[model samples]
Target: MQMPKRQTDDTVAQAAWLYYVGNLSQQEVSTQLGVSRFKVLRMLADAREQGLVRITVEHRTARALALADRLVTTFGLTEAQVAPVGESNTDDTLARNAVAILASGYLARIAASETPVTVGLGWGRTLSAMADNVTGVRNSALTFVSLMGSVTYASHTAPGDVCVRLAAQTGGRAILLPAPFVTDSAAACDGIMAQRLVREAMGVARSADHAFMSVGECREGSILFQSDIFSADQIQQLRDADVVGDCCGVFYRADGTVADIELNRSTPCVQPADMTRMDTVLLAGGLGKRAATLAVLRAGFVKKLLVDEGLAVALLAEAEKQGK
Candidate 1:
């Protein structure tokens, strides 16, 4: 069959534009649109900014969005959100209860029925316990992804595994990220990201509707070091930077300026801007995490904070003391 004349010209323009204007490779464009690599390159160089693309973040308004609002203002989040928890008592119980609530609440907030949702999860004993506590679940099609890998067998399943279990409950999909939380060198993280699974998982994390995470102590390793994610040297470095705690695996100063660490480049768990992409950064965990969570709030990563009465009181008291 003879190729159409007009079609040929369009494809070339599109590929060239993708390459020059969009900073995308011919291979990536081709993969996204199911076109040949040659056409992708050609069109990328030639495509126009006006007609090449249109972008928007779809917001699904909900009651939760309102609660998310109050917290966002209190915490000064770019976007805010809240999740309803299941019943609980123990600290771990409260933590998991929150996840179930978060799951149900996230489902309620989706205004579109067809959009793909990806979630980045950090692991803590509290988060792991939350998985077991999830109840009244609704979503089954959501994609749950792992944000970091494990240094020990005990950490194998991770949030990826928890996502799998939660997905099973909701009938959703689970995408696993393969790289330990901390490594000896940044290059090691870069090497791991080269894998197909790791790359795809990161893409998912970037597009999540909202991220549900807990605070991790940095001066020491919180509960994570027990899992072997960090070494003595890494902890010492955090101490040097006056890192009080961490959010996910990202260490930060009391102000949350991601302390210059050795593992960012190869294994960028997520940037503050990256986390800001979502409308909400739901912060969970307690007591052990009060200082860490507050620093993250001051840095403006989290839009909403979910905590128990006891911790809330402690935070107020701590804040007041600082004021004095």
Candidate 2:
């Protein structure tokens, strides 16, 4: 994600005008230019050195640019968006809404891209909110595949339902994984994976050009805990292992290492290693999910992050404490 040293003069001038005159943030410029915010900062600096911009306009990007730079440098991320949830963020609910709306914009841009797209998705509340807000597009070449199995309830957080809704919104096809997020035993999981439809779903997921997912905290307010998908003893065991959060159904500890638990075997989730191959966008927020979000970031599973300011602050603080 390093900034290029050789950028066109026009590009640098445009970036300078956007930051100093147009009153747009670096994130907005990054989105408009299809480049990283780090690059935009570099371009602005270049503009200053070349005497292209002579005046400074008080704009929001100044603060957002600082935070985004720190996050990308600290986490080694390709891109990071630290969205302002609101002036007052006492409960983190507003932050979640802002993140969902922001994610919808990102999804719409991706759907409108020129190249064909096959997006892989994992289920969670943040992702569900994004699906609800996503602007419908008529891109027949875009396809969505559920990266994990489903929950029984046909709700927003279920993989099958999320994929279906996203596909419907984008005017594409949905390849849902027809199985539970977790089965009674590993043997049952294997039986479902053996099905042709399930195999096809896996193939589609693995072939995705872009992937979107969210982290799940293993706590009282977590969707997994409330869904009754796992027994109380199992949840307790995860706590004993210091399990912080899960991405695509793979639980990991605070240090970002995968937990060696039997529950993973009982779920037909995509391998975490495979996710690193694509452009992965992780959308998550809330103070309650701070630890889990940090864990997923530490695991190096995400290339781009879309998070609220509260969680972004917590992540940077934790990363600094851990010497990340």
Candidate 3:
């Protein structure tokens, strides 16, 4: 019985490898693996069920590229990628994942280069999804630095965790900020920044080659409000002050100036000015994030953008409204 089971496992692996990795037809796989076509089909199904095969679909249409070009020219962006929305993709989660897949492909291509590189990371759900999709890169000297303070609880959207995951996926190292995303006071923030390790990691982040981040709106649906990082009152106060969106935990107004709030001083993330020097890519979508995305684009800090069709259309509409 044991021998029979072992033989079956070997046959399954061979059939799967030939069909999936080797790109052989089912008949070819059946013949090469010395199995019937029916057996090959069963083995392929078994491979999928056992998690031996994973498939990803990415749609890049000329229409999407044309939309990206318009965004680039209108906003002075170096590059943009707009994911086409399928008729069935009304759900926000599906749209976010689509943009993340494009972002993952871009990052993977960058990591494939032989040169040493440092990437700065900001925390959000879309950014976390990008880390999940990164594959087939092994950059021994690559480094990922968290550009924001840590979340109190461990989560995939936490800056530290996202940085660690990207480092692991790229076969490199992670540098995390030790302090909270926001301290209670400027003095407390100063105390944390005074630590040698925190200061060193910040220095490295300032010099990083690329910065990848997501924007958040200052409203009920914001991650800042939902994560309990900022109390409802605090978020309401920001909204009252015309804070439209935020990047790297720093709030900003619709006109793109940093919001004049004391909370800015307590944030342990990359400074807004330093962000201009790095090649910044902002990944965000959904109607909830439209205001935030527009604010970031207006600020002119980002060099690249990855967004979905719905968000892209909304952003352009907002821009036209502002122009008139």
lDDT of candidates 1 onward, in order: 0.59, 0.81, 0.84
- The CA lDDT at 286 in model 2 is 82
Error of 1 at 279 (Å): 3.0
lDDT of 2 by residue, 1-324 (tens): 234544577788889888887899999998888889999999999886775754312233555567778888998899877677532465666677667776777787788888889989998778887876775467888888989988776776787888888887778888888778888777888999999999988988988888898888887777777878897767876878888889898898999999888777788978878886888998887877788888888898789988877777777888888896
Q: Rank the candidates by lDDT, best first.
A: 3, 2, 1
Identify the runs in model 2 with alpha carbons over 4 angstroms from their true place: 1-60, 86-88
Clashing pairs in 2: none
Residue 66 lDDT in model 1?
54
Candidate RMSDs in Å, in order, are: 18.2, 13.5, 3.3
Evaluated at residue 221, the lDDT of candidate 1 is 42
Deviation in angstroms for 40 in model 1? 68
Q: Ranking by TM-score, best first?
A: 3, 2, 1
* Comparison by lDDT, 1 against 2, better one: 2
Query: Which number leads on lDDT?
Result: 3
TM-scores, all models, native as reference: 0.65, 0.78, 0.87
Mark the regions of model 1 whose C-alpha exceeds 4 Å error after superposition: 1-73, 77-114, 264-268, 320-324
Model 3: residues with Cα > 4 Å off, grouped in runs: 1-16, 24-59
Residue-level lDDT tens digits of model 1 in 180-294: 6666788777777777877877878777766667777665445644545556776566667788777667766776577886844434475567776665444554456678777
